[model samples]
Target: MFLSFLYQYRQYLVLGVYVLISVAFMIAKSDRVNVNLKSAAISLISPLQKVVNNVSEASENFWNSIEELKKVKKELVRSREELEKLKGANIEIEELKKENERLKFTLENQKKIEFQTAYAEIIAKDPSNYYSSFIINKGKSQGIKINMPVIAYQGNQKGLVGKIIEVSAGSSKVLPVTGVGSFVGAMMADLRYTGIIKGMGKTSDHVVLEYINKDATINFGDLVVTSGQGGIFPKGIKIGIVLGFQKVKYGLFYKDIKVKPIIDFSQLEDVYVIFKQSEETFYQEGD
Candidate 1:
């Protein structure tokens, strides 16, 4: 009967026995036993604490990496913007440099010229009459007048361009040396052989030095200069270089010498109009 009772209450009996043992242990606890208990508890919890710390550190590291990546990306974008700005600045600098160079070249040419001249720009040029006629950006307002000699600077020497034929308030028309109606009294620079220079238009690409004595020694490369005879152009200004002489098919007392003008009409941009001619050059109104 007792055994049956024990079986029926076995669970409760085991629980009671455990409570009694815990009470006994508490009441009879010693320092060494408590220390051993603490050690065992720490040993069991150490791995779990380490796992938690490792997880926390890993999470912190991931956030730090993300922040570093964002900083790098932002810096890259800023750097790209700065590079583009620098490129624009460089282009502006180059343009300024080119402009400065052009100004310097013009200044150099102006310094070498001796004529009391007015500097003018070629504002209008007709392609059909490119070498024959052009317009300047200065006129009566700038003291420009009809028959004022226009000249260009090239290779450190002044060359005859043409004469102004028409003038307005702020603009003037120039008849170039290559114009059919243009004529200038020219002479050989070294030999003093005098002749007349006559234009044959742009198609000829040259001028004819007429009435040069056939017996005169004509050098192929002799420089032709204004003789200042017709009172139009100043003396010593370069007109052209002698290229060759044309053989007259008929009997003639003069040699037809072909001369290439010193100035390259195709490349003409700026010019100096002799508003106040030298003491030797007297401006005549017509022809």
Candidate 2:
């Protein structure tokens, strides 16, 4: 019975001894003992504390990277949208500049012309034709009529384009001076010599000036303008410049003068129709 009691009491005896030792150490208050205790606790706990801190820092860094990626993605999308808007704005600005230039050129020519005028845009051309004759976006409703002069602004001067050959309610067909059916009364700019300007048939590259006065002087690079004789075109409209002479019979009163037109039909966009000649107006012609 005594041995059984000793075994049961052995656990109590060991716990009491440990508690008494801890109390003695707390109450001693010796600097050397306190230092030794602190060093022992730190030696055992420091590595465990460092491991916990590393785990916490790694989790924080992972979250921070995810947030930064989100911000960068948002910025990229915004930048792309802004870039598209800027591209569209640039295209619109370019279109406005071209329109402004065209209108300014036409306005300057208007100031120099004396006849009543109406502006018309060239709308279409026959795909089969090569003479650059095309249709204008105006017709009888806009006071356009057959034989009305079509003119365009080129460089600092206005060039003679053609005549209105066919008219509909909304459009008119223009016959360029180079057309085979075209003819105009033209005069030399320097010497006041008169002649008839006519288109060469399909094979010729230049138009011909027929019946120039024999007494009048002709030179290369001479400018020609309308005489306003046939009641068709206004006077002072630019026709073309003399290029060379065509071979003909000697001592004839007229020589075949080749003319180079001033207007560049390849770049043509708009034209002005002279609505009146001298005193006769388009209204009177329509009647």
The superposed Cα distance between candidate 2 and the true structure at residue 86, in angstroms, equals: 25
lDDT of each: 0.80, 0.75
Candidate 1 stretches with Cα past 4 Å from truth are: 1-105, 127-131, 249-251, 279-287
- Cand. 2 TM to true fold: 0.59
Question: Tens-digit lDDT track for model 2 on 243-266?
Answer: 988776884776778998777667
**Local accuracy of candidate 1 as per-residue lDDT tens digits, 16-129:** 999998887788666456534543553444445446656876998999889989997997798678769786476567769999988988788878777789998776665584
How high is each candidate's TM-score?
Answer: 0.60, 0.59
Best by lDDT: 1
**Model 2, residue 243: C-alpha shift (Å):** 0.6
